[model samples]
Target chain A: MTSLTSLASSRTPADLLRTSATAVWIFLVVATVTSWALGTDHAFVDNTTAASVVVLLLAFVKVRFVGLYFMELKDAPLPLRALIEAWCLIVCALTVGFFLAG
Target chain B: MTSDVIDAPASPATAPGKKRRIPGEEGTWIFIFGDMCVFAVFFCVYLSARMADPAGFAHDQAELNQNFGAINTVLLLVSSLLVVLATRAVHSPALKRHAPRLLAGAWLCGAGFLGIKALEYAEKVHHGITPQTSDFFMYYFVLTGLHAFHLVLGLAMLTVLIRFASKPEMSRGQFIFFEGGACFWHMVDLLWLVLFPLIFLVR
Candidate 1:
């Protein structure tokens, strides 16, 4: 367990929470607008794929926001946070790798 | 006369006053983590199948309505913001009284998400594009169906938390648990953001 002092030493817990929410909202809005403008047509080719990739990257950023802020993983002991994030990343990598290869 | 053990002070192990650590929270996290892995595998399988039949997948993907997907994404992202606000309200003495209302707002947003998704699905099915129509359709139905299930569960958790919001026994820290559940639900929504464009909008 982490010390309360260390937890409080950084941005007050409330500030961190607010910052995370703001960050997630900005990310979502940006992705929505960009994808809409750029992906108006179902190109099915390289352009669409590029747009999709950008959206997916944005998804990754949003997930990080949720995990660190709402899930309170930022305040958790380092090992536990690493374990959770690492597993998710590995699975994600394997997924993309398998799909890209096939 | 034999002395009665009844109503007597219990042994150290059986002491009623001792706070036994509730294992429920930790166990729930494990369950959720496993659930995430299940989704991860599903995503992988969908991705691989899409790669294998890009042309067919592209054709099916074009049938989907990107507008609806975009709207639903906005709804969910907004709901996540509401949940975060609800958690903050729970912690703040000034706003503690409004926490349930904030949570209710979150649930309403979730319902809106489901409603939009329903309309989208209905329109798709009306156009003669069902899950059986193609491999892409299959992934679309399955992935979105899974997300719908999570949305329902998240709403249920919100309802439960709201019920206890006014109770004296509940503490501000209790909201963190609901916040975590909301986070997972948001992740479900966020995943669809990518899936929609990748599988539907992008064709």
Candidate 2:
């Protein structure tokens, strides 16, 4: 249904290198930069709860992206993939709740 | 639960109704899941302590080197990217030749992370900000110190892997070892992603 499916099905090493892994790396760099900017500006101080949520949300996104792609869990069985995603969601949510309500 | 992607002896002959394969042993994932649970408990303990003395924690956190933390984060992410590239490349006969170089590059990035970490630790200790300085420093050292230990172990594991893979052909078991190592390193990076923000940013 989508181009990514075609890309993923393509087994060429160059294709994999130039596609998902690169895309994930770019996203990670951008996310890190964004978080660093927020940290430097001290936005988290303006509203501690809101800032904590944003920062950790970004963290959650980074972790999930790496796990799914680099770890190749995208090709893993449904049960395993579900378990990994559930771990990410639960840990991120509870950690944020801890900081926000701690 | 693993694959012939890297060490097929030769590619598996196509057949209908064959089971799909995983790259590494099932045990690696199980071990990581347990390790993460332990770290989660550590995180909750740290937060509970921080909650009891938020101001003090914040004050100590401010003394940390954020720029160094940011650099280490990038280093680990780059290393992870290289490991994934190496893994994917192993499936292609045309590009498997490049996997060794990709792995070496990843090792350099990991080394860079540890170098910066050592500098950061030395700077703090020189300034008399050891773990004994406060509860904040205590958490900072214990949590990050444990993490740093894993980073060192990861680097060592990669060293062994790169050496093993230097052969013209790696065994299926060796490929699985490579995959498991990649997962472990990524977990290390994953831990730091949250740790960086929690300790250095989320004041």
- Name the top TM-score candidate: 2
What value does the lDDT take at residue B19 in candidate 2?
Answer: 38
- State the TM-score for model 2: 0.88
Interface root mean square deviation per prediction: 8.2, 4.0
> Which digits, one per residue and each the tens of the lDDT, describe model 2 over residues A45-102?
5766676678789988998888787776776777778877988888887887788877
lDDT of each structure? 0.63, 0.78
Candidate 2 segments whose C-alpha is farther than 4 A from its true place: A1-16, A42-45, B1-20
DockQ of 2: 0.44
What is the DockQ for all candidates, taken in turn?
0.28, 0.44
lDDT of 2 by residue, B1-203 (tens): 33443444224333233334554778998988788878878878888898999989988888888899999999999999888777665555556677788889988998999899899999999999999999989989988889999988988888877776666777777877878888888888888888888788777
lDDT of 1 by residue, B1-203 (tens): 12431111122234344233321156555766677767767877887887788778767766677788778877877777777665555444444566688778888989998998899889988889898988888888888988898888888888887775654335434544555565566556655655665555543
Indicate the docking level reached by candidate 2. Answer: acceptable
Error of 1 at B26 (Å): 1.8
